[model samples]
Target: MSSSIPPSVKPGGHTPHDHDDAEHLKALGYASEFKRDMSAWANFSLGFTYLSPVVGVYTLFAYALATGGPPMIWSFLLVGLGQFTVALVFSEVVAQFPVAGGVYPWARRLWGRRYAWMTGWVYLVALLVTIASVVYGAGPYIASTLGFEANVNTTIMCALGLLALATVINLLGTKVLAVAAMVGFTAEIVGALAVGVWLLITHREHSLGVLFDSFGTGTGGGYLWVFAAAALIGVYQYYGFEACGDVAEEVPDPGRLIPKAMRRTIYIGGAAATFVCLALVLSVSDIPAVISGEDPDPVSTVLNDAFGATGAKVVLGIVLLSFLSCAMSLQAAASRLAYSYGRDGMIIGSALLRRFSPTRRVPPYALILAAVVPAAIVIGSKISTDAITKIISFAALGIYIGFQMVVVAALRARLKGWVPSGKYTLGRWGLPVNVAALIYGIVAIVNMAWPRTPDAPWYDNWIVALSGLVVIGAGLVYMIVHPLHDRSSGPYADAVPENRTKA
Candidate 1:
């Protein structure tokens, strides 16, 4: 991978490679608007920052431990293997399509405009909600670092501030975004490694045998059901790899480089997440209390105990940076998806959303939309304390559903005899991998969306599945009334060379 660098294209000057990339875009029925500036390392950094193991592990450690005991840590490996298959399928699609929007363009070129519209709609909502969730998760760390009280009001305020900050960085264009991602990736890796090693070396409270012991957790249905509920820790950590392909127009040699970046994001991010989880599990001072729900925040307890107040504060600072970087990367991906929708005239306010700032080489209005929608969602936290949790629950489910839609579309195209013709092809492995991805995606979506909180109100229990259905149903109604799919100008499945003239 090349080193992270600034935008390579200069005013009135373009490299031959840049011209070739633009020609490829033209062949796909779109003129290149974004500057091809992000290098291979920058692309990987973007996805890595979005995956952000520090952010994911820190956010959900307490909940997972409380619900499923130490054994829940294995979910990382299970979900990692499943998601790797999905990444392989996506890498091949992106290698062939290499469009601005990740799943939307892939689905559109594989199926039709209608399928792409709904898939994009669901994925866009998920990204916006995820941004809100990440920023809100950072609230406690921000409050602790700044010596402020961590309350609902404080969380909302901090989330809004973080949203605004991320929006500004995104508005500056892809170069600044890439640089920030690189910095975040570096901080996350170093901080995670240092913290994990320190905990394992100086704060080993339990032996490795604890991972096999559940500490009498789980419900009447047994540990299997509870383990599925706790799998969110791993399910949430494996995505954001697709963000590498979301900015396809900004990267050179995307057909080859983006696939490598996506695979790297999954392999490296999964390993980091597993290591961090293992370290924390081994360092927990009171596993029984955590599983029994007596101690609500094991993460804070472990950190404060291992590293004194001063050291914990330093680690909190790193956690805050991870959240900011994750939120920023989500915003970048969301804006590009929105821009792709508008560019095809498949959404409301197409002109405004598709408006590109040539100077910055970004979709400014789209960036604002991404920030504004998530900010609105953050404000909704005032309605109920569980609002953020519900949003997060749906965020993971919605992402998996959107992903499966693309997987199914790809499988359908393959059945119709369409073969991937990009530089990066799975070759004979394509069919089996695509099949495995679809099956895993389906099972994961069901596991994530299933109602498990029987003690809570019905709405809270069903929030994950309900929220996804609501979004998809709303999109269906909009598609019927506005007929945006019919008005779309983007190329469809029939336009591909494999479909029209044979591979």
Candidate 2:
């Protein structure tokens, strides 16, 4: 009854029902065994594409359109640069502890079980909350999909529906998830290009001057740096690529696969998204009108304004589909990350979490649990979409926190002369690179904290208030109550499962 054995054993050992839930992924010809199928490009694509549609197009850019105005394109670049710093740090840590568990495993191995457990809780809960937020955000797009009014109620229902589909897909295993990732990645690339094309075609007379014109400080009464910093919020747009790294073990040749995926995801996604932002900025004829619209959807605003009614509708359909694919990828990622953390005794429900869909080599119970996280947000967004937004945005802070932990580990390792000293390094004074990355993470968290322009139709701060406390508090409680608390510090091994949670 080793909880860590093959991760296929049931409670009593008489062989349980086959995990039929995971077969869809395998049927798509993804590697069945954990650590067998995924590549770095695949993972990177998953994270890259996941963020563009869901956060960039649907969420962050919309925030800019509603708050910062056309200048949001600059914000996109800033955030991208900031997160790029974090990605470098990941390159260091992922090389050493190149396991499937990601930061949770890396933290556990580098520090110890207690801190690792805490990190695991933070990552697990944060991802689910993120999935929730995406669902909350994507619901409207879904409503728009079927030509529904996309009101709060309709959006919530659509989001929940997406969550259901994603849950089923993830439970089917990493292969289907990978396939979806690939499909989603393609969709995002095409979607962004399509939007850009529509913008150019319609706004033939659009001004190229706005691209270089700095707008924020001109009116916000700040220096270029201040406005540039403020604009960086749009930069947070290009995350969620690291989700592929979470399922590292599920992919074949994980070490090589994850890094490749991670790098490609950043480069391609960064380039593609940056192109979209530039296109959006240059292609629009009336910046103020789109920004000030009653429903200021950035992508739609740009496309519709630049093109005509027809062009706008076409772009809208693409954005809608992109969000659906995004929802699917995010849910699958959250589920796998939860399963990985739980199966490794880094979270609660170790016993239940260790059970994989025998037929599909996936974690069904974990996916089921993950579905609820987003579904709840979808429901909450019905009452207060702002709550959903704030909570999820704050959860992003936790993600950066977990990542920084790994970054710190990498620094300490370098100080102690660790192997694999960054074949993928930032090179020529790496310390500055690390420092820049660290500084970016710290700064971005502060910016995301400001409520200068985030107020939305759903009037409430419950998402930020409750989510921050609940998720972080849950992690702390588990760390305090579990036998793996710091006081129990001792040598451990990959095979050991001490202080496993009953839940």
Q: Which candidate comes out best when scored by lDDT?
A: 1
Q: How would you encode candidate 2's per-residue C-alpha lDDT over 383-459 as one tens digit per residue?
A: 77656666676666677667766666555554554444423455555566677877786666655444443464333
- Candidate 1 local Cα displacement, residue 76, angstroms: 0.9
Candidate 1 vs. true structure, TM-score: 0.95
lDDT of 1: 0.89
The list of candidate 2 runs beyond 4 A from truth reads 1-35, 53-55, 65-71, 214-220, 223-232, 290-295, 305-313, 383-386, 421-430, 451-470, 483-503
Task: Look at candidate 1 and give me any clashing residue pairs.
Answer: none
lDDT (Cα, 0-100) at 370 in candidate 2: 81
Alpha carbon lDDT at 407, candidate 1:
91
Residue 173 displacement in candidate 2 (angstroms):
2.4
The TM-score obtained by model 2 is: 0.81
